[model samples]
Target: MDIREYRESDWNQVWTIIEKVFRAGETYAFSPEISELEARNVWIEMPKKTYVAIADDDEILGTYYIKPNQPDLGSHVCNCGYIVSESARGKGVASRLCKHSQQVAVELGFRAMQYNLVVSTNEGAIRLWIKLGFEVVGILPNAYKSKSAGYVDALVMYKELKT
Candidate 1:
């Protein structure tokens, strides 16, 4: 697996991954009915940097975006979101993207990284993140009206990067 900055030409495969993941109503907070343009804006427009994980043949396996947790006074801390292709789950793609994102964030001068809205019911992701050294700093009660879990809380995780 390899990780790299996103390019315009990557959107075709990127969108396919996004569509598959978000439509499943499992991990991300995005609405299942989210349109392609809206999805583009959310995944591309909002982040300071976006990255894709690809296989040896260049098949996109997962993606993530990093941006300031808050602009102006809070730019030192960054926020990130990730999505893995359905077929690529459980294969460490998301973990690789996450580890890479932290490295890139440090190289970009970010002091810390945070995940703002991780669904509490997503045990696999929560476990992976914790194993990756992110701490659950807070929980937003009933933040995600999950399709299966229903009104689940969102875990706010934070990790301080080495300067």
Candidate 2:
């Protein structure tokens, strides 16, 4: 699989996954009825960088976006969000994208990485993140209304990069 910078042509596939995840209301805080243009601005334009994980045939399997946790004084600590294609889940697609994103973050001169809103019910992601060396720095109570889990907490995870 290839994890590389996102291209304009990648938006269609990326949007497919984004729409599904957002509509599911299981993780992201985005409204289920979020429109394409809004999604584009948030996922593409707002980020410092975006990436897609592709198969050998160039089929997009997963995607991630990295940006500043906050602008100016806090920009050195980067932030990220990820979504894996439905068919690609459980195959380590998200894991690879995450690991790759850290390197990319470092290359982009970020000194740390932070996941500001990891839904508490997403155990697989929390587990993988811990395995990758991120710590749960804080928990926002009743932060996300997950479809299946109802009102759930959100974890704020942080990882200091080696610079």
Candidate 3:
């Protein structure tokens, strides 16, 4: 998959993936009832930049957003969220997006990257993030009310992008 900065026309495809993930209450904490306008503002307008992982034919396989972890004094650290289309999960789409995000983050002048609410029960993601060099910096007990797993902890994963 090729990862690149998002385009205006990519919104529908990006929303399709995000809406399904959010509504499932599996990973993201966004309300299932979030409106299109709200989603546009959050996933598109709010971040420093957004990206899409596309296939050879240009079908969007996954998406991610990067932004400052905090405002003002804390803005040197960046944050990101990723979502891969279900059909594209095992194909390394997330891996590509994540690696690409770091490069973009550094290019954008961010010194580190953080993921504030990674659901603990999601072993695959946790493993991948660890493999990608993110450490479990903190854990919020019973943080995410996963639909299937009930109340699960959320992990704060972080990685330094530069020495």
lDDT of each candidate versus the true structure: 0.92, 0.94, 0.92
lDDT of 2 by residue, 51-71 (tens): 999999889999999999999
Candidate 1: the clashing residue pairs are none
lDDT of 1 at 48: 89
> Which residue runs of candidate 2 sit more than 4 Å off their true CA positions?
none
Residue runs of model 3 more than 4 Å from their true location after superposition: none
TM per candidate: 0.96, 0.97, 0.97
lDDT of 3 at 116: 96
C-alpha lDDT of residue 48 in model 2: 90
Which is superior by TM-score, 1 or 3? 3
Task: Please give, for residues 1-163, the per-residue lDDT of candidate 1 as tens digits.
Answer: 8899999999999999899778878678889999999999999998989999999999999999999999888999999888898889999998899999999999989999988999988999999999999999999999998877789999999999999
Residue 3, model 1: Cα distance from true site in angstroms:
0.9
Instruction: Tell me the tens digit of each residue's lDDT in model 3 across 1-163.
Output: 6888999999999999998988888898888778888988999999999999999999999999999999999999999989999889988888889999999999999999999999998899999999999999999999999988899999999999973
Q: Is candidate 1 or candidate 3 better by lDDT?
A: 3
Candidate 3 lDDT score at position 52? 95
Worst 10 residues of 2 by lDDT: 143-152
